[model samples]
Target: MTEDMKMDTVVALLRDQPDPINVLYAVSLMGLTKGLWKVSGAGSAGVTRAFGEDIWRLIKIGSTLLKADQDTSNPQKAMEFYDSYLIGRFNVADSMDYDVTDDSIEITVKNCRAHHYTDYLEENDVPRSVGCPLALGCAAMMEEVTGDPFIVDSIESKDGNSKIVLKKF
Candidate 1:
């Protein structure tokens, strides 16, 4: 299965069920835990593509539901839903880690090879989470767990590892 297809399946399932625990478990089973190996084995989008798509979908759906509740003057219900279904089901690290299924995110390599790449997004002066998109999201998740602000802002221009530095509002 292609990674995008896999992601679409998961998203559809979640949208249908709306059960957070089951959603989390189902995500794990969808080869999210399998990481790069899974991508190379069965998915065509690679690890980054699959993981990024899944997380983005999850966030989009969750935000959509919350917004609907908010515009209806029932933010409490939405907040409660998030608290029970989302927050209670996964930790900050797990939430973000659960998002990205990259072997490199958790893998430890023995041999080292160095290649230099330019960092166009010079995240200086302004504080931004460090490392891969998932890792950075993980840090923001940690903040949320600790009752801190959701730190990492999702760059609309730069969602994943798309070597670009477009302005993100």
Candidate 2:
């Protein structure tokens, strides 16, 4: 099938599913597939780490598509897109505190699923590979939508969280 037709098919499938089912299919499946890949071959751990980054890239791209019409260049609008589209759709963070001023937007995530997953992995003696680089997709998406330069600092804390700052380049 053509690319447009393929995309339409996927969209139709997702649109027909319940919201929770869509979340589980799109979000949980990414993590589950990565986990499975990590155990499938002798060198699969490295491949899984790279795949994690690609998976996040897809998520960010999907978010941009969802907010295609919003004026994301405005810091406030970008914040709205992040909150309304990303967080609202994914429900991945326990708390997402944000500040949007005339010049920039600062987002701090607390009690995120990745943080909890890292904790779980640690408890089970599984190696942790996903890191701030996985957030490249998010920063890139915000930059594209907002016409800003973005940076994500992976805070070295017990919880796996990052502080993302977006400002005009």
Give Cα-based local distance difference scores for all models: 0.31, 0.51
Candidate 1 TM-score, true structure as reference: 0.25
Error of 2 at 58 (Å): 4.9
lDDT (0-100) at residue 122 of candidate 1? 19
TM-score of each: 0.25, 0.45
Query: What is the number of residue pairs that collide in model 1?
Result: 0
Candidate 1 residues lying further than 4 Å off, grouped into runs, are 1-45, 68-133, 136-169
- Which has the greatest TM-score? 2
Per-residue lDDT for 1-169 in model 1, tens only?
4556445544555555456886665445333334433335423323433443455346437767666332212323322333243333333211211221111112111111100000111121111122233323333333333333332332221222221111111
What digit string (tens of lDDT, one per residue) describes model 2 on residues 4-44?
Answer: 64345345435544566654655454455446645664254
C-alpha RMSD in Å of predicted model 2 compared with the true structure: 11.8
